[model samples]
Every structure is written in structure tokens, then in C-alpha cells.
Target: MKYHVVTLGCQMNMSDSERVISVLEEAGYQWTDNEEEAGVIGILACSVRQKAIDKVYSRIHKWNKWKNNKNLVTFISGCILPDDHEKFLKLFDITFQMKDLPELPKMISSYGITTPTHLNVGIDPHNENIEDFWNVQPHYQSNFEAFIPIQNGCDKFCTYCAVPYTRGREVSRPSKDIIAEVALLVAQGYKSITLLGQNVNSYGLDKKGEELTFPQLLREIGELGKRMKKEFWLYFTSPHPRDMTDEVIEVIAEYPVLGKQIHLPMQSGDDKVLMRMNRKHNMEKYRHIVETIRRIIPQATLFTDVIVGFTGETEEQFENTRKAFDEFKFNMSYTAIYSPRPGATSHRWVDDVPLEEKKRRLHQLTEDLRKHNLPYNESLVGQTVRILVRGEDRKEGFLTSYTEGKLTIRFACTDKSMIGQFADVKITSASDFSLEGELVEVAASC
Candidate 1:
């Protein structure tokens, strides 16, 4: 059997799709990038935004056409909003949660496909073709830093969000399991590891005993990286302010292995707007958190997610958000115009923000971000920063990776094999988004 998977949404969804493929492969299914050649198809969906859901609905006809022509057994999974699941289930022959993948091979077995292990909880991906699961095979998609999911789902049900509805409650994988996986990847010559989750800081919160929060996990991983004979990079993402504890900041400050960047989602900057969004934290609390982080790691780069035009956002409220942005001086900001998602608590209220105003606010925010960002990069023009070279730059012969603070820097390197190695680069030029540099020294063998 052969299968094709279409993934959408965040890194968490991408990692889930890969695990689904791992399950299929374990059950003797082959992968085909082409939908026309597959006996089975998987649509790894995203339901965060109404626009995303509409695109999924639009793709139904294409999959239906494939089904009519070749009788493909289509399966849909990944971040599926609860309200749309019934409708999506009707569109595909099968629908299941990404978390239910352990039972997939057995589900296929009933359809006459064979597999090795019994369907049960705590099933290991390492049972068969372990190296492929770690993505050591030459047949894998890309060769660079990899996203290794350490936890799943979210606890924060912000009014405008659908992740909690689609991905269920937060659940953390065992620390031992994650550590072993990291060890395996490092042994296989992987240079970087990005620990992915909806709320990475909330990792291990539900686990038994003294829960391993994001900060604790960072410290543990930092210790492991320090002990490793080889040099490797570590990063995690999309953490909530509620869980951004002090220990995590200290770990990043103390350990050079962990990337000196943190992506904290500040959905809204106005206290009233945040309350309306059920974000829990106030502007004062957020400022203190950022201040603490800066105190702990002065050189740390910060990125954030901001939503413009949330319901009931007045001009003053928007200004408050702008003030927050100015105060933080974020390295990068992902700004979005608020679009109400179905089945979410906030969707019950009127989406009163006008489209034109939303765009205007978004534009204003972008312009302000530019004012702060250019000078920040300019300051790095003479410093030599270590970067893990990932791939060739899109525009020139230079290679690119990220600095400790997750800044994208490009530099000319003499060694072609330096793509996966860390090299010191002396900054020569700076842009709002990237730094131009010249390679100083490429560390050999690590």
C-alpha cells in the first residue's frame, strides 16, 4: 500500500503527520508524494483560523475526485476542530485523532494489512525502522535541524483559539522517552533539535510527581548537551507567558547549547482585551516576565505573536498594544488580523472589528516594529556570532542558519560540508530581518 499526506498548520501538526507516516510504514505502507499514485491519503489539517478550515473544505472535492478514480481510502487527522469533525468525517472514509496513531496499524490490519505490534498505549516508534523515525534515512525530506515533538496539545483555551478543541488537553511525553530520542538523533549526526509543542512551557505539567516544566526540561536538556562530546543546538517554541518560569530563563542564560531566543505569545497587549480573550495574564504581569527574562539573559532575542483587531478593541486599546510592543522591542513579531474561528468561545460574540481597520492596525504595528528592529540588527554589525549552518541562502552563494537569538544570518563559507556544522561569523552588514556576515572559522567534526 502507498499513502500521501497533506499537512497544514503549525510545527506540531507537521510532527504529527510524520508520526502518522511512521505508523503507516510500520504496517507495510509505502509513501508517495503524489496523490494520484496512492492507495490511501491523509489530510493533516489545521482548524485554527476560519480561512484554514475553508481551504480544507475546498480540498475535499480534489480528494473525492481521487477517490472516484482510484478508490483511495482517505484518512483525515491532525488539529481538527471539534465542530468540523463530524462534517469532515463525512468527507473522508476515516477520521481519527493524531494521538490515536498507535492503533493505526491494527486498524489497517482489519483491512488486511499486516503489522508487528499489538494496539496499545505507550507504543514506541522505535519498535521498527527506528532510524527512519529519527529521520536518519537518506529518503527523508530535508537535511537540517529537525523538529522533535516532546509534548502535545494545549491547556490555554484563549477565546479566539481552536487548538484546545482540536488537539485535546495538554499531554507531555515521559522525560526518559524524550531524552532517549534526543540521544538517538545526536548519535545519528543531527546537529540541531527543536522541541515542539502547542505550549512548550507547559510540558510535563500533567505528568506524575514533581512535574518537569519547560524550564526544568530546558535545564535537563542543557545538561545533556553539555555532557555530549559533540556540539549541537537546542530550541523550543510557542511558549505561554503563564508558564514561562524563571528557571527556564536561567537555563538559557547559563547554557550556551540552548538557543538564546524565546517565542512568547502575547495575543493582545491591552488588559481589557486580554481579559476578553481569557488570556489570564495582565499587561503588568507580561512586562514583569519580559523584564525578568531580560535580567536573566540580557542578550536573549525575543519574538512574539500579536493579534490585531480583536473584538471590542478600541483605538486606545490598540495603542496600549503598540506601547507593549515598543516596550518589549521584539526581534520579530507575527501579526495577524483577528478572524473569529467557529466553535470557539469568542466566536459567540460579534466580530465587530472592521476589515479595513484591522488591516490599518496591522500596518501600523508592522511599521512600528520596523523602527525598533533595524537598529537592533545594526548593533550586531561587528560582533562574531556562532551559527549552525543549515542550507544555502535563497539569494546568494552564502550559507545560512540562525544565531543564538534565532536571528537568520548568512555568511560565505569555504567548506561545502559546513552546511550542518556550526561556524563563527563576523557580522559585516545588517538588515531588518537578516544579518550579513563573513565566515570566520568553521568548527571541524562537531
Candidate 2:
């Protein structure tokens, strides 16, 4: 038997697919890249964006057509909104919440597929089985980089977000579990480990008295790093600005393992636009946070998320965002044009921004980002930086990797063994989005 999992959406979804792969592999199934060769197919779906949902529908339609001749079982999970879930139930062989992943092998058995073991069945899908879901060891797809989910779901009801509806209220994993996972990965020679969560900085808030706070969690990981002889970079993502604290910044500065890269999402630079999106934090507060990061982690590279031409946005408001791009000089920005999602709070309001204008605003922000990023890339010329060689580049005889600050750089290297190792590379040239470098030396072999 063979299984294939099609992953969509954010890094969190990618991490979830690893767990799904673990379950399938444990059930005596081999992994396959070709969907036609697999008996079981799964989709780690994402409903946050309409485009992603469209892809799910298109893919499942073709998969269903193949089912007319092939014996295949298909399932869907991860970040699925209720409306989309209702629809997916009809298209997929079985649709379940991500928390019900432990019972997936049982579900396969019920479909008349035999496995090596009789796994426990009849687990309630309605129960909060998040702990069981987290217990499943991920079939880590990368030898060098891994994502450890510290928390699941969201509590902040950002008007433009579908996370609260799809994944439910916030739930933090036990700090001990997180620390153990990081320690094991570090010991296994992983070079990069990102702590995953929707709102990472707000970790342990739901537990209040029981679990460690986000900064405290970082301190624990820092202690583990100090004890170990190996070198690695730690990162986390998509933290709500409202929960970003000075203590978190200080802890990051205190630890050498914690990479000097912060992805603070500034959805909009205009206060009113932010208010309309229910982001909770004003532009002034965001600016103060940036200032704190700069003062504490002076060598840090900044990244951000921005939405262009949001509902009721004016030309002046868009210009304000452009000015913010100039002010922040972000190394990279994941900018998107606003699109109404079905279950989000913003869906009820008028999508007043014209589609063409929305596209124009998106392009404008992208141009602003390029204008800021190129200069920083150029500044690194002749500087030697340590990078984890991730894969081979499209250009032959070159390998692609990211610097300590998560800047993408391709350097000339023919050694295949360097793919999962660290190397020092001297920058030779620069581009708006990436850099060209020459390999200086292999820093470490993992």
C-alpha cells in the first residue's frame, strides 16, 4: 500500500501533513509522490484563502474521477472552515478534524483496507483530543529543518482571519513536550527548528497558571541549547502584535540559538485600516515594538505580513502603508490583496475596495518592498554568512540555502552531502529577492 498527501496553506499545515504521513506509514503503507500509484490519498486542506479552497475542489474532482477505475481512499484535514468542511464531506471518502488524526488508521480499516495492526477505533471526533494529535511523532520531511507546534488554534478574532472559526480557541501544548521535541531534533543534527502557532507569543495564556509563558519557553530552549554541543537556529511565526512583549525580545537577544529574525505582521500602516480589520494594536504600538526589537536585537532582520486595499481602504491609507514600507525597510513582506473569506467577520461588510485597485495596491507595496530589500542585500556583498544548504538550485552546479537571518542565497556547490549541513558562504552578488554567493567552507556536517 502507498499513500500520498497534498498539503496546502501555511507552514502549520505543512507540519500537520507530517503527522498524517506518520500515521499512514505506521499502518504499513509506503509513501509515494505519484498520486496514481497510491491506494490512499489525503489533502491537508486550507480554507483561509479562496484560492487555496479552489485548488482543493479542483484536485478532489480529478481524484474522484480516478476512483471510477482505481481503488483509493481519500480524506481531508487541517484549517478547514465549517462551510468548506460540509462540502468536503461529500467529495472525500472521510473528512475529519486534525485532532482526530490518531483514529485515521482505524478509519482506513473500516474502509476494508487491512494493516499490520488493529489500531484502537471509535475515538470521538467531537472531543478535544489535541493532546493525542500532538503525541503522534511527525515523519519529519526534512533532515535539517523541522517545525514543532507549541500551540494550536487562535483566540484573537481578527476580522480578516478564519483561524478562530476553523481551528477553534487557543490551546497550548505542554512546555515539557515542546522542550523534549526540540532537544531530540537538536540532538539528531537538525539545523533549524521553528516553533509553530497561530499566535505564538500568546502561548500558555490559556493555561494561565499551569504552562510556561512564551518567553519562559524560549528560556528553557536556550538552556537546552547551552547544554548541547550542536549549533542550530530557533524560530517561531505569525505571533499577534498585541501579545508581543518586551520580555520576548529580551529572551531572543539573550539566546544565540534563537535566530535574529522577527516576522511581526503589520497588516496595515494606517490606524483606521487596522481598526477596521480588528487587529487590536495601533500603528504607534507596532512602531514601538519595531523600535524595541531594533534596540535589543540590532543585527536582526525584519519580516512582515501586509494586506493591500482592505475593505473601505482609501488611496491615502494605501499611501500610508507605502510610507510604512519605506520606514520599516522590511527584508521581506508577505503581502496579499484582500479577499473576503466565507466565515470571517469581514465577509459581512462590503468589500468596497475595487479588484483592479486592490491588485494595483498589491503591486505598489511589492515595488516598495523591492526598493527596500535590494539595498540591504547589496550591503551584504563581500560579507561571509553561515547558511544551511537546503537543496540544489535550478542553475546547475549551485545549491540553495538561507542565511542566519533567513535570507535566500544560492551558492556554487556540487557536493550532495552538503544539502543537510551548514556552510559559510561569501556574498558575490545581490538581487531584489535573493543573493548569489560562493562557498567559503563547510561549517559543520550533520
Candidate 3:
């Protein structure tokens, strides 16, 4: 049997799909890229974004249609909101949470598709099964880049978000397991490692006294990097401002392995809008964290997530967000047009922001980002910076890569063999978001 997992949403979902792949492969099912070739097609979905949720429905519809003529097993997993969860149960052959991944093989076997471990019972999917989910050896899709899930779920239930309803309470994975995975990946020549979580920096807060804090965890990893003497970039994402401590910034400043890139999500710039979203932090708190990042790690490229339209968001409130773009001068901003989602707190409230207005606001923010982003890239015109060779670019004869700060740069490279290696590149020209450069030197992955 062949299987294909269609992943959507955040890096956390991508990491979850890795474990899901592990379970499917263990059941004697071979992997497939084409959906038509697979007997088992699973979707690792996201309920956070409206578009991703829409894709889930569209994909399952086609899969179900295919089942009219062919014998196929379709399953759905990952972060699913209450509304989507109910609907998915009626659509997919098997519907389960990410924590219940161990039950997947058994559930599929009920359809007469037997596997080696189909009869293995007594595994409770509803209990604290996230720990067991983590124990499943991941079949990573990428050889050079990897995502290590350090935490699962969300505790801070923002009003406009459905993550709390979907993922449940926060649970930090053991630091030892994460560390071991990181060490093994580094030893196996992985160049990029990102720690994944809903609230990544708030890692140890759930288990306070027993576990290492986020900074402590980074310190341990930094020490490990120093001992190993390998060239790699360590990154984490989407950390809440409430959990963005100065200690974490200090740790990153002290560590050589930690990438000079920060992705702090500032959902809205206006204080009133933030309060309406129940984001738990004001604009001032977010500003202070940005100040700390700039002061501590001056070279760090700042990235953020922003929502354009929310319930009752006024013109002044949106103008505040526009002003914030210039104030922060983010390198890359993921601007989202807000839409009410079922299972989220704000969904009950009237979605007053018109769709056209929301789109206008999003486009305006993109323009604002371009105004600031281009100049920064232009400043690197003649500077030689070390970048990790990621892969070939859309334009032939050039390979795409990223700086330590995660800035995209494409340079002429006839040798695709240098994909996983590090190379020093001298910038010749710049675009709004990417740069053009010439390769100066190449270093093999250690």
C-alpha cells in the first residue's frame, strides 16, 4: 500500500506530519507523492487559518469522490477546531487528533486493511498521549533542515484564535529528548534546526520547577554547539510577546548557533484592537520586547505576524498598525486578512470588517513593508556574508540561500552539490525581499 500526507498550516503541523508518516510507514505502507497512486491518503490540517480549513474540505471532497471507483483509506489529523472536527468525522474514513497518532494504524485496519500492528490495543488516545506521539521516530522529509517540536498545544487562548480549542492545554516535551534529537541531527549533517511550539519561548512554564526554562534550554544547546564545533543555525518561531523575556534575548546574544532572526507575532498594533482580540499584551509591551531585541542583538532580522481586520477594528486602529510597520521596520511580515472562525471567541461577535476593506488594509501593509524592507536589503550591496545553500532557485544557474538573519539571497552556482553546505557570498544587487550575489567561498558541512 502507498500513502501520502498532505500537510497544511504551521511548522508544528509539519513536524506532526513527520510522526504521522512514521506510523504509516511502520504499517507496511510505502510513501507516494501523487495522491492518485496512494491507497491511504491522510491530511494533517490546520484550523488556525480560514484558507487552510477550506483546503481541508476541498481535498477530502475529491478524495471521497475517488473512493466511489477505487479502494482508498483517507484519514485526517493535526490541529482541528471543534467545528471542523465534527465535520471531518463525517468526511474522512478516520478522524483523530495528533496525540492519537498511535491509533491510526488500528483504525485503518478496521476497514479490512490489515497491518502488522493492527491488533495492538489498550492505547488510550484521549489521555496524555502526546508524550507517546513524540516517542514515535519521525521520518523527516528534509535532510538538511529539520523541525524539533519542543512543546505541544496552547495555554494563552486569544479571543480571535481557535488553537486553544484545537490543541488543548500546553505540554512541554522533556528537554533531554529534544536535546538528543538535536544532537543526532547535527551529527547527521543537518544545517538548520528549528524548535517548534504554539508558544515556543514559554516552553518550561507548564512544568516550572522540574524542567529547564526556554533560556536554560537554549544555553544547554549553545554549550553543546560550542563543544561540537559545527556550523549550523538554530531558530524558533511565533513566540508570544508575553513570554518574550530579556533573558531569552541575552541567551541568543551569547550563543553562536542561535540564528539572528526573531519571529514575534504582533497580531494588532492598536491597544484597543489587541484588547478586543484578548491578546493579553498591549502595544507598549510588544514595543519594549522589540527594543530589547534591537539593543541585545543588533544584527537580528525582525519578523512578525499581523492581522488586518478584526471585529470592530476602526480606521484609527488600522492606522496604528500601519505606523507600527514603519516603527518596527520588520524584515518579513506575514499579514493576514482576519475572518471569523467557529470555536474562536471572537466568532460570536459580529464580523464588522468588510472583506474588501480587509483586503485593502492587507495590501496597504504589504506596501508599507516593501518601503522599509528594500532599503535594508540595499544596504548589504557590497558586504560579504555567510549563507547556508538551501537549494536551486526558480531561475536556472542560481541557487537560493539565506543569511544568518534569514534573508533570502540567490547566487550563481553551477554546482548543485553545494546545496547543504555553507558559502560566503558577496552581494552584487538587491530586490525588495531577496538579494543577488556571487559565491566567494564554500565550506563543507561538518
Query: Using lDDT as the measure, which candidate wins?
Result: 2
lDDT of 1 by residue, 1-446 (tens): 88888888887777766677777886789998877888877788888777777878887778797655676676677777666776775676666665566656555555434231222122122223222333311122445577777666677889998777776677777676678777767777777778888888888777756567677778888888878776777888878888777778888888877888888889888999999998978888888889988898888898999999999999999999999888999999999999888878888999998999999999999998988999999999999988888787876666787887889998765456788877788999998888998877544422
Residues 1-446 of candidate 3 have per-residue lDDT tens digits of: 99999999878888898999999899999998999999999998888767888899999999999999999988887778766776776787777776768778878878655542342222132326788888888999889999999988888989988888888888899999999999999999999999999899999998999999999999999998998999888999779999989999999999999988999999889999999888889999999999999999999999999998899999999999999998999999999899887679988899999999999999999999999999999999999999999998999878999999999999987687898888899999998989999877643321
What lDDT score goes with residue 22 in model 2? Answer: 94
Candidate lDDT (C-alpha), each:
0.77, 0.89, 0.88
lDDT of 2 by residue, 131-242 (tens): 8999999999999899999888888899999888888878899999999999999999999999999999999998998989999999999989999968999999978899
TM-score of each: 0.90, 0.93, 0.93
Query: Which segments of candidate 1 are over 4 A away from where they belong?
Result: 109-141, 208-210, 413-416, 442-446
Selected candidate, larger lDDT, 2 vs 3 = 2
After superposing candidate 3, which stretches have Cα over 4 Å from the reference? 112-127, 442-446
> What TM-score does model 1 achieve against the real structure?
0.90
Displacement of residue 50 (Cα, Å) in model 1 is 2.0
Which ranges in model 2 have alpha carbons more than 4 Å from their true place?
112-127, 442-446
Q: Count the backbone clashes (under 3 Å) in each candidate.
A: 0, 0, 0
